[model samples]
Target: MTGAVESPFWTFVKQSVKSLFIVAFALSATSYTDDVVGSFEGLETGLSAALNTSTATTPKTTYEALDQSLGKGLDLIKICTENADAAGFNIGTAIGWLIAAAVIAFGTTLVTVIGGAVLIVSKFALAVMFAVGPLFIMLLLFPITARLFDSWFSQVLNFTLTIVILAVVMAMATTAYDAFIASVDLNSNSGESPMWAAVEIGALTGVLVWIILQISHMATGLAGGMSMAAMGIRHLMSPVTGGLSAARTAGNIINPVSTRRDLESGMMASGTRFDHMIAGNTVINPAYRQHVMQNIGKNWGWQKGGSVKN
Candidate 1:
């Protein structure tokens, strides 16, 4: 016995059910789901606390962790700057070190604040995407709407990668700061200036800033590329839309009443003979061409055969 082919609706239903089951299983098996859900819940709680003129009691929230890390990094810079004299530096060298320290401190602050804000925003966006992911998956059930799902998935992936990159970069910068602090010998009496240490810190800060900028550029490029792809897909689908429009026009042409009414409307609405001909109100003949030339001559104050009127 031969098997029957499934209808499109049933096929879509089966695919949707299978996809949902797979997503449910994957979510249950992964810690990432918990992290996203927890972060969203934490955000809600934090907002509520702020609105009530209270403080959030949640420990190790994403923002709290970022603040703690940034604070420690700043503290390390403070120690280096504050104890510059303990390294047996002369007054001039000490002054130089302090200047460098000030610049490096400003750079560090800028990097940390911008990086932390990006990470926090990206994480929250990821959580939001996850919340609406099922709707996109359902959109994927139809070929006509699949591009919407693709665009959604691309954005979700971009946010995820951005968050991961920012987190890793921040962690590395923090570790580098801690290591630099540990390497400083404040008790040394060898008359060595801490100016070199200040230079190293400044260089590290510059490098960190460059890395963050590169990551931002990369994220923007990815989003821009996805947008271009989506536009291309829409361009490709234009023919389908045009075909539907053509079908409506054909239906109008096939009905005698509609055809007569459309011709009358076209003639009444047209501003020139060319417009009437183009709108199917009249046939394109020598008379229509001569009429167009005459109208153009009148509008431009010119005679036919390329002669201008005085």
Candidate 2:
């Protein structure tokens, strides 16, 4: 009786350990990507401080380049044509490591699930839960469409770029909003054209919109990471369920019903919805870029004229 009680508890502890490794592998998979993303963030931070500091003179050339690439004449597709090697990872290395990690994680979980299928109720559910993530990655990286992965990766990279671009736009809008708000003395003057006031409203509102979108993007990424962690841990804990398999249709019922299909099946049943949520949204997706770009375009015109046009 005590053995029965103690068995599942040990199993849960074991699965928990495996989940930690999933995060470690995922981080490594996208290692250099972050550096590239971070550099752009650094550029943005520099820009934000450049105006008050004497260094603005030195960066005038850079600022000009930024202004040009990000403005009206921008051809969005140019991003892919001149793409850099993914920051810390070569396309080859990231692919290799990521593939290997999935294979190992899946295979390991498969063996455990097949052998342990009759132990616990949660294990049956967990076995199904864990299979989801790696399967998505495998599908995304499968050879025929692997090239598309680069495009997808680029899309995300571009999203990162949009973040920097959006930051700059907000900076300009903020400057304009403040100037507009400061110039008008509502208490002192009669109601003048609310156009400048409207610009203030528009800029502030635009910044708020961008902030919300960016936050959503970040939240999705966080969800994916958490899903991976949870799946990895769940697999480690629930080694046995009395069933045919849980990874596929027959397996989900477990016990006299199913068994895990493969390592992928044992490890993840459904793609981590959270991870998918992250994968689905990119900072540089056309929608996001278009939003910021359109606003910037409008602001660019307005900045040039310092007035509204129809």
What C-alpha lDDT do the candidate models reach, one value each? 0.58, 0.36
Query: Who wins the lDDT comparison?
Result: 1
lDDT of 2 by residue, 254-309 (tens): 42322221222223233333332343322345554454455554534433436658
Error of 2 at 260 (Å): 61
User: Stretches of candidate 2 above 4 Å error?
Assistant: 1-145, 188-310
lDDT of 2 at 135: 38
Q: Give me the displacement of residue 171 in model 1, in angstroms.
A: 2.1
The weakest ten consecutive residues by lDDT in model 2 span 72-81
lDDT of 1 by residue, 7-62 (tens): 64434444565556435633563543565345544544454344332225222333
Predicted model with the maximum TM-score: 1
Sliding window of 10 residues with minimal summed lDDT for model 1: 257-266
